[model samples]
Target: MKSPGLTLVSYGGKRYRFDAGALCTELLTTGGPGEFARYESLHEPADLLRWVERSRLPSGLEMPVSEGELAETRALRNALFQVVADRAHGRPLAARELAAVNLAAAGAPLAARIEADGSRGWAPGATVARLLATVAREAVELLTGPYADRFRECGSGNCGLLFVDTSRPGRRRWCAMEHCGNVHKVRAHRARRAEGDD
Candidate 1:
């Protein structure tokens, strides 16, 4: 069953569940740089709104998104991709990518409010600026926080998804055990059998 923060992705007609483990990493799925651009889903403003709804952030936020924000969002996402890939591979942080993330995070994030029913809600005046800021801020935190060393690219050699390992042992290796992990296990088993080692 689908849970909050988990998004289903279709790869060449095969559907798989993906949990990016952090709000920022989740945005990487919408689109990315170079070859990843083929997966672009933010060609229109409505697309960004849809992404917000699907994001790990709680629902009930209404905001207006402009064409410029849409463009900015794509740029932020692209920068984030490089930042994450670099970090995951133990490389030095790229100054340009770090600057883009910091620039967006400088904007005001979405404010929080307590509802009459004792539930959490967003404060008034939500906007795409706040949404992007929230995402960028989270990226900043994830990159510098306790789990900074825990963030990793998917273990599948060909999978480009990134995730932070929040589990107690921090042994997470795949984007989702039900997806990449299983595939790896099956492939390994077949290889063993083919070699008469099974």
Candidate 2:
């Protein structure tokens, strides 16, 4: 189910929410080296957001999920799970640069250059590749650098949550107050009562 602490981006007049799944995919944590190496394996950014919005698990107080929705949600859950595990275990980063190069070469002189030069030396393909690589690298660097703190995981004990820390203080912890925050508060009150009796 939709966990707390996901990030949202506004692009093309639409708001795209990014959860652990998108982050892991963006970071190329899905599949083995070869799979991630092929950028085609990556889902479209919009699809990723749709997937996140559609998947949500019930917290303790909520009713149990229906069978159909449960299965669909679980599949989405598994996607993020595998990605997180890969990242935690230090899986190799995908060859995104190569993918970027291939994408940038579409409809350009790069295809002809490859045929002419036998894939060697400076050519249209190489130029496109270089430019694509530069842009991708810079984008990633900027995201994970100055805005590094904005990338965060949720702190709720019961949620498999992750979120971007976009709060003014960059101290955001919960994804939603209606869920995790209330759960935590109740837990704390119970804990305090127990402490008082002892």
Candidate 3:
């Protein structure tokens, strides 16, 4: 009954709690054990572990999964995760990624409108590369916009977890009320009781 975060949608509807820090590990498709391990070692193990705990991957696909393949795939996912992270942080896109997009936008914007009152015509897909570039642009927008707003970091005591705010008021607190939220409340109550006893 629980909802998943944006990163977990990578498996194409096969939901699972995917650790964001280990994104590269989940996405790299063609690599050996040493390579995968080195990639995973880039981040702090504890942080990645915490992210893994909060991540959720969907189920239902009949995947021919293997340990080796999973590692490679995770690495590939990592690459995508980095891109989203960079975009969120307002960093420039990598050189290779931007070259073609820049070239196309140079001549004419990818998605544009004519003023009709005498303006230049819009030619978005002037080339194949530009069309595919448009698709990638839209994908990133969808993720950081709707998806980012939907799932936010918990307001609890820095638990390093994120949850989907599916409440009617769109103000759900903590990753789960039965877990982190309840624990925090109980701790606060105990502290108050100790003060009263004193």
Q: Could you give candidate 1's per-residue lDDT for residues 1-198 as a string of tens digits?
A: 125455566466666777788888889988899988988999999998898778777778888888998999999999999999899999999999899999999999999888898877899999888888998999999889998998899999988888778888999999888788998999999998999963
Regions of model 2 farther than 4 Å from truth: 1-142
Question: Would you list the rank order by TM-score, best first?
Answer: 1, 3, 2
lDDT of 3: 0.40
Q: What's the CA error at residue 88 for candidate 2, in Å?
A: 10
Q: What are the candidates' C-alpha RMSDs?
A: 2.0, 15.6, 13.2
Query: What lDDT does each candidate get?
Result: 0.87, 0.39, 0.40
lDDT of 1 at 11: 66
Cα lDDT of model 2 by residue, 1-198, tens digit:
345333443223433344432332233222223333332222433443343234331121112234443333233334433433333334642454334323433423312223353532233332323322332343344335654435444467444344434456766666455556666889999999999999
Strongest candidate by lDDT: 1
Consecutive 10-residue window with the lowest summed lDDT within model 1: 1-10
Local accuracy of candidate 3 as per-residue lDDT tens digits, 75-133: 43344444443454456656543443333334421444555665434343343233223
Q: Give the true-structure RMSD of model 1.
A: 2.0
Question: Which 10 successive residues of model 3 have the least lDDT summed?
Answer: 22-31
